[model samples]
Target: MRLSTYEIILPLVGTDEKPIEGYTLLTNGLYGAVDVVPKEDADKLQAGDFAGLPAALRERLMLRGHITRKDEAGELADLKLLSRIFKTIQGRSGVGLVIMPTYDCNFRCPYCFEQHRLKKGQDWLDNTMSDEMIETVFDALKDYRARGYMVNGCSFYGGEPFLAKNLGVVKKIADKCREMDLSMGAITNGYDLETYLDFIEEYKLRSLQVTVDGTAELNDRRRLHKDGLPTYDRILRNVELALQRGVRVNLRVNVGKENLHGMKDLIDDLKARGFIAKEEERAKEEEELRKTDPQAKTKRGQFSYYFKATTDDAHPEKNISEQDTIDEMMKIGFTAEEAVARQSQYNMIWNRMKNLFKKEGYPDFSPAYCGAEMGMLVVDPFGKVFSCWDVVGKDDQATGYIQPGMSRFLWNFNKAKWRTRTVDLIPACQSCPYAFICRGGCASRSSNAYDDYFREFCGEIREIFAFTASRLAGQEWEKRRAAAAAGEASMDACAGELTLSLAGPASRFTEAERAKIMETNSQKEMFDIVKGAAFFPEPE
Candidate 1:
């Protein structure tokens, strides 16, 4: 039997600052099942000598089909595996669909990527999705349903989705989704949310991805009205109302060098305004939501926050490196280590890794990073269809268009082009450990930056992993120290759970309680052991 090419060994360290006897082995190439083997067995398997390993361990490795039989042929090639992923993606239902009501946006953020597209007179207003385009969208949805596929939901994307002018288009799409029994979401700037609150409530919007870079002063410099008026207070008020009305708000903070220091103040202000309310406050809100919105699963607890590193634009004046932003965050309050580590912990890469791990049992794998390749088609104002929102307004990126008297879209080569792109096509991604999570990152970003479909920002990805690993290693050290007190030399029982808990979900605790969980490990160690022990009830 031969080891899978995708299997990787990550060294684990114990209390003595030395490598633990065993390594943590993870498999990726198979496109099915995730196996984690302890170090001793991994060592034996690595040497092609599994004689001393436990029967169950060997049987599992064999059962998972990662290990190839000497009598049978070896594992499938990358190209073959990729083909399977593509076919799998094509067959799936509840695929995500995004529609841009209008290219017009109220806020003019400095780093807006669309600015470049708009600079050459893109004619955003005239390009808004029309009634005819909405009919074409319904036609597409009906076609999908006939093909035995249901859309997960519709997302309203825009220069700003909640614009007063776009309300008709938004309502039309939402009405169609309701008729088809689908959920809905939006990526709005929040400036016009108050105007759309009734529409949001009527459709029971699942979530809103809103940007609030920092406080009013810092944010106004970037996200401003075309009239150059400040929108901070109004946006915040709308955000609070959304949460109170049971809509989960994913507050996106676009971090850069200029606005890095404003983050602490933003957090403080959010807390003070009851935007980031206490548990009791959240509980009260949820209780009210239960009566008014039984269909809404967006509880107060799910109103989360995220930090996105601002992407570089043609305008170098606004460009800032992630490291610079991290350093500035450290200056504000976070420790030098935490400033770097937090970015990784909360990054999309890490989130995708966690989801990939969950897929071991769930098996809900996504062939592409998003729905762009398989099921999703972005319909712009003029009935132009694109693969992603990033390329919605670009004429060259349009895959097809909704023409009169057409059963399907008028043919475009790019449709087939994006659908066929998988890890196998990119030599760099084929061998990279994070390939499954990144899916070669954003294709548009790669093409624009490298002028190659296969090239990606591998360096930034590696740095993020480095920061996460370093922080995890520090946690391992604390686990060892705690295990030492219990006269245990190994982390087999409680230590593994304690170390993994950090990655599982964020838990709320008082400052003193958090100290115990992090420093002493008394509370966390006990909690992990009990939770792990009783994960499943004893057989009756």
Candidate 2:
């Protein structure tokens, strides 16, 4: 047997009262299993002294993928095969279409990435999708559905989708979605959300993602109107109105050095408005309902918020690194875990790994970072279709075009280029330990950084993964310790259930083999007796 290449080992720093000394936390990046073992056992495994370990320990290690059969092909090969299967499944699952009604905006945020497209006298500003175009878009969706691509939903995107002038187009699109039995959502500035609340409620809008840079003072200075008027109060009021009308609001706080200090005040303001309390209550109610009905759907309109690091190439000095933002978040009364959760991208990877450790199933592996490489297609006002939202307005970056008579989008080589950009194709990502998790990073960012779509634009991914693994390991160690204390037979506090499936011909193990391994020993029970005793000592 040989140790997996993706093993991450760290020293366990227990509490002052009960120091978990001489133990190491180990995790496999690919398998997403976490365990605590004695330092000597880890050393023995590293030294390739498998015979020196107990038979039960060896069996457990193999089961968790910490150690694999020497004849096995390897984890990297398995990951590549799994990723391809995942991509194939994603392509058929559904297509998430982004509709840009108009490129015109009511706000002129200094750090807006779409500023170039919103310039004065630009044709993009005057280009709004006509009612005919809206009808054509829905027709294209129906065509895609007929072609075997499920129509997942439609999301409104633009310089600002909720601009007062674009209300007619927005309503038309929402009405079509309602007619098609499709869910509708939007990414808007929220200043004009109140005007659309009636439509939002009527169409059963699933969600709205709105950005609020900071508290009123900080936000007003940042997300200002085109004429330099304050937008904070009006936006907040409209957000509250949307919530009252049963529209889920995802409040995004753009954090930078300039407004990082105001996050606490912003969160405090949200709490004062009862937004946080409402979300907490909704969460509790949903948890209770799910206890009775595992598949029960929860009501919409719960207000939740996350912090995102601002990106401003024009004002590089004002932007804060993600780590710095997390640290600042910690200073503002967030735990390390909570602060990490604020970064959506990192949090997504962290959550996937966390879920993998808790459940008995393979990670939802993907070769691409997001839907750009999957089935996501963004259509702008002028019939330009893009694979990535960041390149929506750039003609050269457009993947295709759509017109009134076209039954389907007229895709070009650019679409294939985007669809084929996966971790396997990226040379750097192939051998990288976090290849499956990072998936070659964002395609647009990669192109912007290396001037090539296929190159690696690994931005803080290693650091993020390290932090995530450490946090996950620490949490798992604590769970096992608690389980031992409570005299539980398993470390998994929840019911143990695992799902196994075959990927393709190249897959290492069959479904039956996977099931057999799972039945050998419960993951928790494998570590239940480490070196002839429970992992944790009994209380006095």
Candidate 3:
């Protein structure tokens, strides 16, 4: 038997505030199984000397697939098989349709990533989607349904899809969506949302992602209009109107070094406007409601917000690191947990892995990072189709296009290239322990960084994973410690029970074969170690 190549070992702390002598928290990133084990046994297995460990411990490890038979099909092959299975399942699920009416925007944000497309002047900006093109897009959706793929929903996107000029186009799309029985949503700046309120109410608009970077003063300094006008009051008022009309609002804060410290002021403004409530206020209200109504439940708010670090490759100096943003959030009265949850894209992978561990003790296998590779079709104003939203206006990046007369999509080689950019195809990710979890990171970012889509764009993933695992291990250790202190079961008993529940069947290798395998490779190569380190500041 041999140790799995996908295991991460972290030192476990004891109840007495000291590092446990020889115990370590071992987590298999591929399987998402976590356990506490003796460091000596782990070392033995790492050295291909599994027979030196106790039989019970060895059996438990084998059951969890942490230790496998030497002759068994390798983990890389298993990963590839899982990738193929996931891709097949996703293909049969549905397709996401993104409609970009125009690439023109009233506001000129300093850190906008679409500046490359926006700088093409009025002639290019005036190329809005015509009524005929809208019909063709729906026709394409019809073709997708005919191919047995469900039309999931339509999301409005663009330089700004909710601009006053696009209201007619927006209504046409909404009318079509209603006829087709598909839901509608949008990612807008919220400046002209008032103009679309009638449309929103008529169609039961599912959701709107609107950005409110900071307080009025700070936000206007960042997200300003082309005519150099302040946009905070107008956007906030429209957002409130949308929420009142029963549409869910996701208020996004594009955090940068300049506005990172202004989040507290923005939160205060939200609370003042009754858009958000303090934890204590919410608790008191819930308690009062329960007294009056036996079946009373806390009201679910129509609006929510999250902080996302700005991505501006042109001006790297203007960007704020995620850790710094989270630190500032904690300083502004957010708990460690709250801060972690509110930070949007930074901890997405870590959050997914953590939630899966809680729900299933293992993560669902993922072949690709996002819907772009699976079934997302982003159609720009000119009917240019792109797999990823990041490369929407770039002609070379477009995977296909929808002609006025063609009912079916005219796909090119780029679509196949995107569809096949799975974790298995990336050389560096093929044998990496965190391949399934990270899924080779963002495809657009990878292409930009390495100038090749196939190259891996790691982007601080190792540090993020190590930090998250360390925090989880610390929490688990404390939970066990607390349970023992209350005259409950001992730590060893708790660990054994957890192992049995997580581990499945016995090893495929027999005793004789296992012993021979162990003795053959006395100096086996160790898996890459990710040290348990803190990337974010610890809460006081």
Candidate 4:
């Protein structure tokens, strides 16, 4: 009879047996022990029941399961530990994916990379994706079951994706997604707006970053048809109709010196419509609420906060501070009283936001991620899978295209390719300092604007980041203001309230003392000081 010896590890969650430094534990403090058993009886005295032990030893035997498939209990525990560890490290959550259905565009905008398609002329058309070709795309997505990703379905695009005259195409895709109940939608520049009305309302198109080159005269000049005809008026009409029907519309402007003038006009047009819709919706909601709860009176500027990036890099109250917003409000409203009133409301909104930020987590914060890393396989209108939307029609170096049926190409990158892509990846496109949450900016736009994929629109992004962060900070400030807004209170009451909110009451402990206390009491501090530390945070 053969004899086998095995040592089992027991995890000690609540013990002094902490891990050593640098080498973090895959499993926690496991007590040590070994057992000798006959091969024929190996299964009987394994894990839960081990052979030959005193009652005290039996209670604390620390049976670390075998690291093999023969120990089914050990194997199951290993898998569970693996799953837990994976979740902790990878987050393993699905992110939103945007599939550009087509790069074929109607308008030949001077700024658009899509115009490059027009410049390349028939080459893009020859390569354009047909409706039938899309089936292969869908099937390829199905083949990726082994990888843990869910395709949110395709976001149709094009030389105006509508140019396909594929109304049935959307319905067919929508029908399949409806059966599967997937998030499917499309982006269009509104050439065939009326036809796609039903699809927009029904599908609830998640995103619509439609390109608006400039104003009526400027836009018409920029976004021209195949024969170089103006399209601003037609597109605007379509946008208006879509908005009226409650289609989600994000008025996008590619800001350059030429079109900066048109942006304000575009905003004015959209805002008037938006405010009118807001008023109607507000009234409807109020009526319904009155019928139901009746006690929700939203103060002015409650929907959105108003604030500007300040000199201190903090979002503060606007009283006597934000002159730019005041000036802009006048232009947006086109009346002095209207401007002043709106500015006041905006200031109040900002105040409320600042107050909220003091105690709450980041609110309405959308991370600015480099869309490339998130597994968005954007197949241009011709069914060419390009990574960068703006890189479409260019050479494979600039454009992110791959052959059909080759591979769905999961975003999990190789080191050589990652380095190469990173070299191609503009430093500006590097992981944002805030990308532990906010992703970096778009690689394609950076490449197109600067001709360096690694270089970024840093100034634009910094301003946006500051602006976004300030708004978040402003929310916290608002909460502080409200807490302080309590009219008449005793000195003790005020002191107590303030002390409760602040990290360490000024009256109780000094900063050094508090810091020591935090370091000592914090769980992270408790475990980190131990022998081994295995994990590191994901790259920022």
Candidate 4 least-lDDT 10 residues: 24-33
TM-scores of the models, in the given order? 0.74, 0.85, 0.82, 0.55
Residue 464's C-alpha lDDT in candidate 4? 32
- Candidate 3 lDDT tens digits, 458-536: 7766766665555555556667667887868575645632222222311233455434333342212100000012211
Q: Give the number of the best model, judged by TM-score.
A: 2
lDDT of 2 by residue, 259-315 (tens): 988888988898998888878887788788899899664564778788888878778
Candidate 1 lDDT over 1-540, as tens digits, reads 766554444554343435545455344433434444576777788788865778877765765544545221223243233334334433344556777887888877778878755664546454666677677777877776787677667888977878977787789878878888888899999998998888887788989988888998988987878889988899888887887677878888888767766778887888788765653566666677779777544344346665667775565566566666666666777764455434633354444444443333222234355566566777776778887777777788788887645555664998887766665456666655555545566776677678864465453655555444434443444565577778776544432222121111112233454333334424335355334434212445
Which residue pairs in candidate 1 have backbone atoms (N, alpha carbon, C) closer than 3 angstroms, thus clashing?
22-39, 23-39, 127-381, 128-381, 129-381
Query: What's model 3's lDDT at 385?
Result: 96
| lDDT by residue for model 4 (1-540), tens | 111122221211111123222211111111111122232223333433445434433332232222212343332232222223223223223323444444555566554445546666565464545556556555555555335555555566665666546676566656655654566656677767778776776775544545565567776765667677767767766766666555455554444434434546665655564644664576576677678777753221112112232221111131123345445545554343233233332343344334433434212122223345434455554445555455555555333333456445333232123123321133432323322122234455455456755444433433332332233332222344456576543333322111111101111333454344334634334234221222232244
Order the candidate numbers by TM-score, best to worst.
Answer: 2, 3, 1, 4
